[model samples]
Target: MSSFRVKGGLKLKGEITPQGAKNEALQILCAVLLTEEKVTINKIPNIRDVNKLIELLADMGVKVEKVGPESYTFQADEVDLNYLDTQDFLKKASALRGSVMILGPLLARFGTGRLSKPGGDKIGRRRLDTHFVGFQKLGAKFEYDSKQEIYKIDGTNLKGTYMLLDEASVTGTANILMAAVMAEGQTTIYNAACEPYLQQLCDMLNRMGAKITGVGSNLLNIEGVEKLNGTEHTLLPDMIEIGSFIGLAAMTKSEITIKNVQVEKLGIIPETFRRMGIKLEIKGDDIYIPSQEHYEIETFIDGSILTIADAIWPGFTPDLLSIVLVTATQAKGTVLVHQKMFESRLFFVDKLIDMGAQIILCDPHRATVIGLDRKYPLRGIRMTSPDIRAGVSLLIAALSAEGTSVIDNIEQIDRGYQYIDQRLNALGADIVRID
Candidate 1:
């Protein structure tokens, strides 16, 4: 297992550019299977999960070419449908949660899609019901083999209709939308996830001949087209990474500028950090967070304790709650972080507590952080990364602590973050990867 030996108590300075959105890249990469024409994608993050998805595509006979350091051109002219039934396919696809996305495109185009139980962060139970149910609603025959833990979907004669999702799941919406793009008729999806990345998918599909309306709203109307063509698409900067950088700057008392952040799509992330008393400035498209000796948390208008909770898009993202929880450690006041979406995310607070932060693990879903006001800096210790967001949060804590901290299982961090140590080292952080 790879681990990170992070030397703490160093301030990082310099401009860092956030990588391409990991979440969006997964959806966009899967969409490449919809057409046989050449589709070029830029700003692809060189991360483990995204790289694994690309490898899966290549193994499935999609022709992939590297055009630049962060650009790739893909053509699915001769996809091997037989590969989907192979044990190698199950082994590769089951390891990636993004693999489930390929089902929609494959089902829509080739009439059959099969997947083993997909794997990802073990944060909590992320059900595949939404994806399968939405497919079933689109006239696809769904069957599950309990013994093999495989899902089979057949869309021989898909004809779209209306669907009101039980939840606005981002991946679920992307999967269903991809299938609906080439269905026989109109498909209306209410309560759809309207995240910026999903909107980008809709825009990309529209550019490729799919008629999709309500680009930024929950109600998406898709008029199915007979075919889709290839188009060039550029992914947005990862907002989660941007938020993590903001937290890192505040926690380590660093003067850092995050460049080309696509500020308009960040959606209340900056303001949410400001509510934690962290001072940041917006310059054109970059975010400048100045160093601070101490910051404080804000209270509600009625003078109640501030609660930082995650909601659907337009609300604060759940991905950053771990960052927010860690950033609140050195602030002046206390804040309750409600991780509504995932139960196990707040479990990392025990590690922060070990680092001299005062945090109360109220339950599996919530944590109360009492800021130390920087009076006593966190002292580093040995810990293990549990999930992607929690792993990055622990890294931020280790960076601000006194002395060196050894973090095991940093592969979790690498899955989402691209060259995190190298990038931070450029900004003056002292981190060594012990492979």
Candidate 2:
């Protein structure tokens, strides 16, 4: 395993361009199975999870060729459906949560899919019951071995119908949407996750001739099509990484610019940071953050202390709550962070507390941060990453701390961010990777 050793107290400057969205890239890659023609995807992030998904695609007889630094051509015309049952396929599929998306296209195009339980950050018990229930409503039958965690899905012709997801699970929503596009009848999905990534998926599917409506809302209406054709699509820039960069610039008091951020697609992200009193300048597709001395936490309407929380769609994304919490540690005021989605996500505040952050862990899901206000910088300390978001949060914390800090379990960071150390170093961040 590798770790990041950082000499902190460095002001990161210069422009950094974010790679493609990892979530969107994974869903787009799986959509390749829906067509026989060659699909070229540009700006795909070269990350561990993406590489694992590509390997899974290759194992299933899909031809993937790297045409550029962050571009690939994928053709699934010669897929072997039986490859899903192999141990290698099972291992790779079970390693990431995005693997569950393969089930939809696989079952839709090939009539069946077999795989093991999917694994990801152990934030909470993310149930696939919503996914299976939605698929079953669309004429798919699912059988699973609880002991081995193997799942088998079989269906003849997927017939779309009115379905309501119990929870707006992101992957679950994507899986059902993929399946419904090629179904026999009209599919109406209520309480769907309409995040930017899902919106991109819907847009790409429509480009490939799948009829979908309500692109940015909780209710999605998809018309089942007989076939989908291949098309070249460019993935959206990583909004989560863009948010992370914004926080890093604020904490380190750096003047930095983020390039090619799809300003229109970043729903509620820039506004959420603005609530923290961080001003941003938009120059076309780029976001510029000038040097900042302190961030002020906004108060509620009734003049009460402000508490920022995360919700499903059109709300601040739950993935960014960790970065918000760490950024608050260096801000000028106090705020309570309520993470409703994941239970274990707030546990990383303990590491921030060890670095002299004034944090009160209200519970497993809430934390109150008292900002240092430039009166004191965080002290460097050794910490282990618990998951992907927390790992990157620690890296952000380390960048603003004094002296040296070591962050272990960096593979967790590798699962999401592509060439993170190199990219950050280009922005004048003092980070080194060590094994």
Candidate 3:
């Protein structure tokens, strides 16, 4: 097992470029399967989950060539359908939830897709009902082997039909949209996920001859095409990482610049930080966070304690809530952080409390953080990372603490973060990756 050994109480300086969007890359990478021609993708994050998906594609007969450190070219000229039916393929696909998306492309192009129960962060109930039900709307048959926990989807006669998603699930919408792109007739998706990830996927598909409109809205209309051609796409900077850097700089009182962040696409992320009274300057695609002795949490307009909550796209992303919650521990005022989307996310705050932060876990989805006002710096303690976001939050807390800290189960962090230890080391962080 890999662990992160962090020495706390050090100010991190310098700038680091944000990695490519992990969520977006997952959907976009699966999109390569929609065409047989060569697709060149740049800005692909070299993380465990994404790399695993690329390896899975290679196993399924896609020609994957590493053209650059963060770039790849994929050609699905000869997909091995029989390979998908193997136990080996099932074992590989079960390692990450992104693998569930292959079902859409596989069924769309080859009329059948089989997969094992995909694994990912155990944050909450991340159901795939929306994805399977959407496929059923497009003339697909969905079956499950309860014994093996496997899914078999067949879309031999997929025809376009309208679908209003139960929720604006990011992965579910992307999967169904990919399947609909080449199906017969038209497909109208109401309440579609309008996150940048889905928008990028639609843009790439449209460039490949698929007629899709409503790029940045909850409503999407996709016209089926005979096939999608090869296309090139580049990923935007990861907003979650940018937010994490902002929180890191605040908690550690360090001057840090996050390079090349697309400020436009980071809808409510910056403002959310501002609401916490954190000082930040947005300079033409970069975020400059000045070191501060103390950052205060703001009150509501009617003079109530501030509350930060998560919602769908155009709202505060759920991914950054963990970072914000940890940063709030050292701020000057108390604030209530309500993680409405997931139940178990707020549970990690107990770990922060163990590190000398004053936080009240009101429920599974909400917490009231009473800031320490920088009076008592947290002392490092041994801890285990629960999930991807929480893992990073603990690391930030450990860095802000006053002693040495060891965080176990760091592979959870590796699944999303690419070369995090090496990247932070360049910024003067004393983080040693140990096995």
What TM-score would each prediction reach against the true structure?
A: 0.99, 0.98, 0.99
TM-score computed on alpha carbons, candidate 2: 0.98
Q: After superposing candidate 1, which stretches have Cα over 4 Å from the reference? A: none
Collision pairs in model 3: none
By descending TM-score, how would the candidates be arranged? 1, 3, 2
Candidate 3: count the clashes. 0
Clashes of each: 0, 0, 0
Residue-by-residue lDDT tens digits, candidate 2, 212-259: 999989999999998899999999999999999998899888999999
lDDT by residue for model 1 (53-131), tens: 9999999999999999999999999999999999999999999999999999998888899999999999988998999
Ranking by lDDT: 1, 3, 2
Steric clash pairs (candidate 2): none
Q: Roughly what TM-score does model 3 have, to 2 decimal places?
A: 0.99
Candidate 3 regions exceeding 4 Å error are none
Would you list the clashing residue pairs of candidate 1?
none
- Greater-lDDT candidate between 1 and 3: 1
Worst 10 residues of 1 by lDDT: 341-350
